[model samples]
Target: MALRHFFLILLVVSIWAFNNIAIKWGLLDLPPLMLTTLRFVVVALILVPFTRVNLHQLRYLAVLAFTFGFMHFSLMFISLNNTDAGTAAVIVQLGTPIAMLLAMVILKEKLRLVQLLGIAISLSGVVVLSGSPTIPNWWVLVLMLLSAFGWAISNMIVKKSPPISPLTMTGWLSFLAIPIVGCASWLTESDQITLLVNASWRGWFAILFSAIGSSIVAYSLWYSLLKHYNVNLIMPYSLLTPVLAVIMGVLVLGDSMNGFKVTGSLLVILGTAIAVINLRNLRMHAKLARFRYAGRSKGH
Candidate 1:
């Protein structure tokens, strides 16, 4: 990957790290499903006018809307409401391995041995983080895992679907998700009108930031990168998200942290660095070997 693209991924990670905080703040004023509904509303209103999709693309987008937009966001928000942002962040990292496995099975992408080791190390970190005392409920863990599964499935859909601009994908996705999540909110949540009317600026800002920063900007870039790179390569960068989220959760949300959390954070970071750096080294070595082989062929 180019340095610019790497930095872009880092940017997405940073946005998402703060996104955990945003959702936590938003939950102060709105129910989980209601907050998700409003988020898609904002996204649809802004991007739908600019989006264009065909029947074929729409088929993929509809599934993506449900899986990524509805299932992932709704479950994630609910889980975040139940658990600390840091714990939720760590748990969601399970999506990394899930996506990698799906890429191998669905997209037929291969992973290096080192990559596998890195994934294992990262998962062990997640395991350690899962034991954090901050996680208040076990049911939230299950919800988060399901949410991560939904996310992994959505990634496969994005990779398999025909080429589409990131903007179109994000727009149609948000548009399609509105009714699904909206109905969910209607059925399970109450006081939507009252909440929206009385929501603080922080709550509203959370909605706007989640809609524009996390959805429009971060996801669009993420989709573009997915189109260009293998899932195994792209997914590891997300491990860094939990580390940032944990730190912010401690500072901003007053979430607890301990030696175990610190160890897990370091392990996650180490695993991610190993995956990225080793993959780059492998590519460079392959290029050098190819150049040498070409020189020998020309001489012969």
Candidate 2:
């Protein structure tokens, strides 16, 4: 990528990193599931009128809704509600490595030696940080792991499925998720909507930002980069999310920092960098492609 595009990718990473902070702030006064419901509701309301889904591809979309929408957001929301956002962010960083393992086992993608080391590093970080008493009874830990799995599965489905604008995907998933999660909230909790009505303004503000900024705008930018940039270049930048999340949690959300969190955070960043940069050759090709695209546009 050109320096400009690289900087743009960095900007996108920063936005995503802030997403953890944003979501944590939103959950302050809002109930976990209920806040999630509102976030998706806004996303659906905004996106429904604009994008139409391909009915033929409903099967793939259904899978996306189940994994990405219902499971991922529900679990993450519940997890963040119970713990510090920084810790949740660090733990949720497991999704990338877990996805790699799934891709290797089921998709038969072979891992290079360095990639294997990266996996080991990430898993070690997970083991080091997971020794909290809160994890045993903490709904957040289990919920976050489920969210990560949902994300990984959805990623696999998205890889083979016919291309849809991420906007349409997010919208459909958000709309579809409403009833699924609403039913879940109803059955699991006594009444979540009541919590919505009773939530503070700060909570509502957080919900709106999570909907518009994190889910809608951040996702839109990310998929746009996927169109223009290679995954090798883009994926590494995503590691910034949890790092930013931890910083925001401490500086913004008042979560205290400790030695283990700092160490785990470093390991996660280092492992992600090792894995993503392992594709340096592909990244070169992607940069060349971006230049050709830009040159062609200028010629026109």
lDDT of each: 0.83, 0.77
The CA lDDT at 71 in model 1 is 73
Candidate 2 per-residue lDDT over residues 149-190, each given as its tens digit: 888888888888898878888898888888877777777765
Off by over 4 Å in 2: 1-7, 132-139, 282-300
TM-score of 1: 0.82
lDDT of 1 by residue, 1-300 (tens): 678999999999999999999999999998999999889989889988977889999999999999999878889999999988877777676676677777877788997788677778877776776676666566766788889889889989888899888877888898999999999999998989999999998789889999999988898888888988776567767767888898889899898878777777677667655644556756775687699889989999
- Stretches off by above 4 angstroms in model 1 are 1-11, 220-238, 266-300
TM-score of 2: 0.88
Looking at model 2, the pairs that clash are 1-287
The superposed Cα distance between candidate 1 and the true structure at residue 64, in angstroms, equals 0.6
RMSD of each: 5.1, 3.8
